[model samples]
Target: MSEKNRDGKRTARERLAVEREKQKSAEKRRRTLIVGAGVVCVLGLAAVIGVLAANAGKDKKGSEEAGPVVAPSGAQGKDSLAIPVGKDGAKSTLTVWEDFRCPACQAFEAAYRPTLHELADAGKLRVEYHLVRLIDGNLGGSGSLRAANAAACAQDAGKFREYHDVLYANQPEESDDAFGSDDRLIELAGKVQGLDTPAFRKCVKDGTHNSWVNKSHQAFEAGHFGGTPTVLFGGKNIYQDQSMTPAKLKEMVEAANRG
Candidate 1:
């Protein structure tokens, strides 16, 4: 009876050990899964933040107040460039020359895009966007030439609107962070859909076709532009005088149509 008792005790001990080992293995697996999940969540959040920052850094700034708060136009010009806004009353084609890094350019976009949209929708204004990069400096800096080139690269991949809208929307706070570095620009480039990222990088880094941007910059500065959103109608320069409200812009456009 004593020997039988001893054997029973040994068997019970072995079973207990097995159970404990099984529990230990399960705990290890749970910890591993938890760690993996945390990593994924962090990565996703980082991506979201990057996108939002890029968008905000690209829009709105101040400009000159001279002729009309907004540029004016006549009946839609013949075979000129247009982004097409509104189809009401008279139609006029207007050209916009913009520098990506300019604060005034940013301000102009915010003030004008809605009216332009309304007019295009109403067959009133056909606005042609001529994106002019005026940023200059190294990859890690911001300038007119740099901005123009980067934007041009973005355009090649058929992401002109996305890139344009994003940059204009994100116009950086007027400060050291605005003319963002090459890495910053590349990061900004990543947010747009269908933009070929690697190719865009190669183009901006190598300064390929940089001359194209230089010429535009020279032309703008020489043209006596003191601010962005320089408006031209049928080859005539539209002047700016005060801070433009939507109402003011419409007034100018209507008056130009009459003249």
Candidate 2:
């Protein structure tokens, strides 16, 4: 063969090899892009599932027919787990609607715990606790409902007040879903004497009071309440008034008793 023709054939072979290499590199890039897209899609799906599971309790109508929601003994209003703080038939009724996951409710409880307990212990008035789950609905977590259910379970064990106080005392950050876990709830129950029993554990884990929690939230909405820590004195919504204080609450109760 002619030298020029041989050289030209070699050059052609070299160019073909380069083209093949470029094709292989492009195919590798394409595969990488496809793999990356698949990974993103999977991650996005996982995030969506996580959000849905966390927010499962946000729906007020969920699992309403799950079981019979037994209200606590002597519970007032519809689906409430009322813990009476004073003597029966005390002239005044101080109704409170609170969510365990609510920061404002925690603050209210802290500020008024002393005065309210003092008045109740003195038999001057009756405080009716109506547990609700506004926080769970507003925030994307089941902590409020789970905590409320646990409180109802406490009611069954005859330690509602003790458990209620401890729950608020150990309340996690409003945004955290720690209370959504039954283990954390049971752990907190240890703080209340005689509350960490087998029955209590079963009730908390099984979500025995989930239906009741839903019902209580229904009642709150039915009553047209705006948010958590709603305080009503003599059927008058008093929590909306920011000026109201613990001292004022005492005076209001005294006057109601006087009437």
Candidate 3:
């Protein structure tokens, strides 16, 4: 072969080798970029999953802090929120929504206690008392909640009626937060025989029925009543009537019993 022809062929082979090297370098760069992109995508997904897990944990913790709604023993009606005070066979049902720290509730209880007792004892009427925290919400104190919880504790001890009377009889002023003290509540429990036991004290101190009282208050708000001392008879709001009295209540109950 001529020397010039050999040189030209060798140069052509060298050029081909350089071109192949350039292609290999480009491919390596492309593969590196693809791998880096994949890593970025994986890290982004991990961050998203971490945020979701954290939010889920917060939700679970909030639910735990809210605790459970435990209804009292022998509580009737929806969610077992009503504390029944008479025989189940009574002809008429009187629904009373009351807050222990409410002066109006105390007045209503004072006015109707005897008649209510008479009707309940005679099996002519059944009183379903629903305790609420209206005063606590309005007055910005925990007295209503504490007292309602104590009342539920009393119900657990089978001394709800007597203790309920004692609470109303000794209720503080409208703005007073006297009932907020667990000691005072436990002290008052002494008025009722067999009600000041260790179990009762523990129930009161632990606020065992605080959640239940909160649920009852929620039910009251859902009911959309005007305020505390909401007394209902035969599906009518008798407490709203200006002329309503214990005599009138007794007469209505007797009439219902007759029917």
| All models, RMSD in angstroms | 18.4, 17.5, 27.3
lDDT tens string, model 3, 1-259? Answer: 9999999999999999999999999999765542343333233323433444443443221111265787888999999999999999999999999888776677678778999999999989999999987655444457788899899999998999999999988988757888988999999999999999999999988888888887887788688776667789877888767687899989988988898
The TM-score-based order of candidates, best leading, equals 3, 2, 1
Task: Give each model's whole-structure lDDT.
Answer: 0.54, 0.75, 0.79
Residue range 13-108, candidate 2, lDDT tens digits: 999999999999999976554234333323322353345566665544333327778675556654445656678878888888888877767777
Off by over 4 Å in 3: 1-65
lDDT of 1 by residue, 1-259 (tens): 6999999999999999999999999999665542343333233233423443454444322111012211112212332212223343555777777766655566567656778767666665667654444332111134444555566666555565567767778766433445445666677777886664678788666554345554444455566643355677657655353444567667767676667
Clashing pairs in 2: none
Decide which is better by TM-score, 2 or 3.
3
Best by lDDT: 3
What's the true lDDT of residue 35 in model 1? 37
